[model samples]
Target: MIVAIKYPNGQPYHDSTHQPLSKKAADSKPVQHGHRGMSLEQELNRANEFYLQRGIANIHKKPTPIQIVHVDYPKRAAAKITEAYFQQASTTDYNGIYQGHYLDFDAKETNSPTAFPLNNLHQHQVTHLLDTKRLGGISFLIIRFTKYQETYCVPIDAINQFWERRKTERQSIPYQAIVQHGVLIQPSLYPSLPYLEAVDHII
Candidate 1:
């Protein structure tokens, strides 16, 4: 069974081996839930903005292209988009430059405790990330375990390996594998997810 561990005062609640510590022995407060209601997209947007303000990195979310089919305009009012459909998005969610390296990644959140379902990712996304990696760009997936309020930055190479193993393996990547191979990130007040720090270790 999965037991949620709360980290108060931004301290690491887990041991070096990532085993959750006993709550009774640790003097800590409860996990704050103020930002829990926000969606992952909103969190990334805020984090990107934080990065930009600090002049540390310049990253932005890719806007989804919409094919507007119909629009109604009133003489004294603004036009309203009536009908529209999404154009196929080619690349990952966010891409930009950081420390002279091209960065590309997709953000995902899962509620599952045992494993992360492969179905959450698309074949096109995998191909895009692989191509980016081949081109010498840093590519990865930012996965958040929403249930545990834990987040990790997993390299594209690791993802590619599991992605290829799907042919003969299970449809999901086990959580233990992720913890072993992925970089765990502590959420911060600014640059919220602070994923780039994990990237620092990777590169």
Candidate 2:
């Protein structure tokens, strides 16, 4: 079967293949232990589900808009997406209503223990968040530092401050600064990462 995927700008997607490590090599590698058992997205999804079930908030991940170019049907009952293209660049990871205010945010994770790379966010996304904030909506970022197993709800103001500083100084936001300005979201059993608890502080 052949499959092709392209970005909205018409650039073809390239899948980078990685070789699997042998058993011995995999076992030999040092594993960093942390309380987080799931990725940032998964944790948030679980949290959103919890919120939804309890009638707390109606938050959800935004689905990427895509156009199917081709479909392959080898059997009558089996069909495969053979070709597709993204309709446009996504604005954010998630958006919905919470506590009578519109919520818009993106989930981001960094391996770096000291800082978050500014380049991780695109200009379009920044613009979208800023625009949302200007219109009296809640806009923020959910950032996770894998090494520390810590997640934070960083407000748009903090992002704007560091974003402007990047042009004149460093290319990343210092971990300490984020810790000072952002609210730490603790992981829980039912909701997983209880980020809205942090959002409560933000609003």
Candidate 3:
């Protein structure tokens, strides 16, 4: 029989491990929500900015890129570009050095109570994460169970299982499975992701 487990905080789990497991790993990137004056993404970006200002740590979302196709030699010191194209993202959303450790992670969100879709993840991200792990870097995924208003820190080892089981449509990791292997996190204004706390528990 498939057993159900619940954490003390009232979240459900898959079994004894307490990390949520699903077929899909990281699904669509999660966007911040519900700040009247600002978009959720804007609010979180501001929070990230504030954290950077406080010198608590240096972590920033990866920047968007634009390709240059045409240029005009306008001056001796400057050139003007006439054509450009937006470039696809090459890495996970957020990454940087924290507490002398190299940190790499991505944020994803799903409204599903049962699963966090694997469709949210990309092949390149899996490759990047694998490389980081080999180099002794701290690599993980940040998942937001939007329905429950809960977030979790999922490690790569658990993530790899979903990667290995890629032959089926059961892609997204269910919230119950997440509760099995992942560490629950409650983000706050001051600390933002509060990943360090989760990292402490995980390592």
Pick the TM-score winner.
Answer: 1
Off by over 4 Å in 1: 1-34
lDDT per residue, candidate 3, 67-135, as tens digits?
A: 989988754434556799998777777787767778787877787889888888898887787788779
**CA lDDT, candidate 2, residue 115:** 99
Off by over 4 Å in 2: 1-35, 72-79, 86-88
Ranking by lDDT: 2, 1, 3
Write down the TM-score for model 1. 0.80
Residue-level lDDT tens digits of model 1 in 11-32: 4355442222234422365355
Alpha-carbon lDDT of model 1: 0.79
Cα lDDT for residue 80, candidate 2: 66
Per-residue CA lDDT of model 2 for 102-186, tens digit only, reads 9999989999999999999888888899999999999999989889888999998998899988989999999999999999997
- In candidate 3, stretches whose alpha carbon ends up further than 4 angstroms from where it belongs are 1-44, 71-82, 189-192
Root-mean-square deviation of each candidate, in angstroms? 12.2, 9.9, 16.4
| lDDT: worst 10-residue window of model 3 | 17-26
- Give the Å error, residue 31, model 2: 23
**Models ranked on TM-score:** 1, 2, 3
TM-score of every candidate: 0.80, 0.78, 0.69
